[model samples]
Target: MIAIDNILVSDDVVREQFVCDLAKCKGGCCEDGDAGAPLEKGELDEINAIYDIVKPYLTPAGIKEIETRGRYQYDREFGWVTPTIEGKMCAYGYRDEKGVIKCGIEQAYYDGKTSWKKPISCHLYPIKISMTKEGEVVNYEPRETMCRPGCIQGKKLKVPVYVFLKEALIRKYGEDFYGVLEQVAGSYFAKAEKQNK
Candidate 1:
């Protein structure tokens, strides 16, 4: 594990290559999960504050779900999460013209209707974060079947997971943390290469 401040990052985060192939996956991550996207406590307020502005970007069904159940719901296993549409897709997501599921909140952000993007968990996907007794533990956990195209694409393009998720990482842990992670990754990969040689 690579220690960055209090967060313990799995080595696979630096070693594994991954770049989302949206065309192939069709944003399955948004629709396939059992529960809706995990939400941080502070994000609940953000979602509530922006719901009105973001409503237009969502599907009618999604809007209904949100209105009926409130902005966010509590889950026994996952604590706070965005509500799902009848246990299917996230209520905050809608199918685009291409039939690909997309985050309505993100669309609203892109349209400048709202300043906040989607949840941080959704932004930093394939990297699951869990709070441990010590600190936050970050792990690389790509969906085996759903992420096949991404895996192939990443390997072909030679983009490591850390590099692919640079923006999200910076957003989550600040630029300084990411800078240290990049340095650590460089040194780790170089040492591995030398050993292989």
Candidate 2:
């Protein structure tokens, strides 16, 4: 594990490669999970605040689910999460013209209708975060089947998971933290390369 401040980042985060191949996976992560995307407590308010603006970007089914179930729901396992469409796609998600599932909230953000992009959890996908008594534990947790394309693409492109998730990490931690992580990753890879020689 690489210790950055109080956070403990799993080695896989630096070793394993991953880049979301949305075209191939068709945004399966938004729909395949048992529950909606995990939400931080503060994000609940953000969702509620932006729901009206994001609504038009969503699908009819998603809008109905959100309207009926509320903007977000509580899950025993995941605590707060976006409501799912009949236990399938997320209520905040919609299928694009290409039939790929996409986050309505993100689309709204891209369109400049909202400042918030989406949930941090959604942005930090493939890297699950857990708050421990000591600090935050960050782990690489890509879905084996659904993330295969991304994994392959990452390896082919030689993009480590940390690099691929640089933006999200910076957003979650901060630029300073990301810079330290990059230094750690550089040392980690260099040592491995030397050992292989």
Candidate 3:
């Protein structure tokens, strides 16, 4: 693990490869989970504030689910989560013509309806944050069954998990922290290359 400020980053994030293949997965992560998208405490407020703007883009089913579920809920395992439709697709999800699940919140953001781009948790997917006695521990979740296509694509593109998640990492931790992480990853990979040779 590498420590930067208060965050502990797992080495797997550097060693592993991943890239979301929306065509193959069709945004399955948003629909296949037991619960809805995870949310930070502050995100609740944004959901409420942006619901009006996002509502227009959402499907009728999504709108109904949101109206009934009250935007967010507490899960036994995930704690705070966005409500799901009958424990399936997120209340904020819509399907495109190709049947790819799309985030209504993100659609609104792209449409210039809201400044806050969906939940940070959603943006930083496949990487989950857990609170330890020491600090926040960031780990790459290996949901291989769900993300096989991404794994294949990542290997083909030579994109490590850290590189694939660069934008989200920078969003969660500042650019300086991400830069430091990049340096650490470079050193780690370089050392591995030397040992392998």
Candidate 4:
């Protein structure tokens, strides 16, 4: 436990860099190609709204499958991407002309139209949040997952995520929402480790 704490604390302190060469491969994180990513609250709303709009365009059975699927899970403790629909890539995942997996929502945002309404986890790529038990945030940290090139990198190099979450509250939501999210992230982090182990 002490070692885990130390690694977590120290890793959160120093930023790490990994440049993804998407040209070398199709989007590794696309659908079954890689683990999914965590979704943010606003993202959920955006996706659901898109679903309502797009469902009419899909086959009846396809719409049924989506509606019958279980409620999407959101782990608040440790940040983890939500599960993707079976037999499909991420709802917002797409391939560019060069066959790179591009984010639908991001493109939408860039085009000045209704974006895919993607999760914050997707928006704040390479950067993650962390929190502590007493309801205090730890800091923000740089995550090393490979992503498309030209993504934004931040200074403060790395900070404790939970700590940063708390800090972000003033800029976004109030304490009550962030407090609950901290617990969710903590739980998700634990679950991810157990699975990997």
Per-candidate total of colliding backbone pairs: 0, 0, 0, 26
In model 1, the runs with Cα more than 4 Å from the true position are none
For candidate 1, the clash count comes to 0
Screening candidate 1 with a backbone cut-off below 3 angstroms (N, C-alpha, C), the clashing residue pairs are: none
Error of 3 at 124 (Å): 0.7
Question: Against the hidden true structure, what lDDT does model 4 obtain?
Answer: 0.47
Query: lDDT tens string, model 1, 1-197?
Result: 99988899999999999999999999999988878899999998999799889988888899899889989999999989999989999998988778788999999999888888889999999999999998999999999999999999999999999999999999999999999999999999999999999
**How displaced is residue 175 in candidate 3, in Å?**
1.1
| Candidate 3 C-alpha lDDT tens digits along 1-197 | 99999999999899999989999899998888878888888888988888888888988887888787688999999989998888899888989999899998998888888998889888998898999899999999857787899999999999999999998999899899999999999999999999999
lDDT of each: 0.92, 0.92, 0.89, 0.47
Provide the TM-score for each candidate, comma-separated: 0.98, 0.97, 0.96, 0.46
> How far is 68's C-alpha from truth in model 3 (Å)?
1.5
lDDT value, residue 90 of candidate 2: 89
Cα miss at 169, model 2 (Å)?
A: 0.6
Error of 2 at 63 (Å): 1.1
RMSD values for the candidates in order, in angstroms, are 0.8, 0.9, 1.1, 11.2
lDDT of 4 by residue, 55-121 (tens): 4333444445446752244445534454454645664466677977766555665655654535655
- Candidate 2 residue pairs in clash (backbone atoms < 3 Å): none
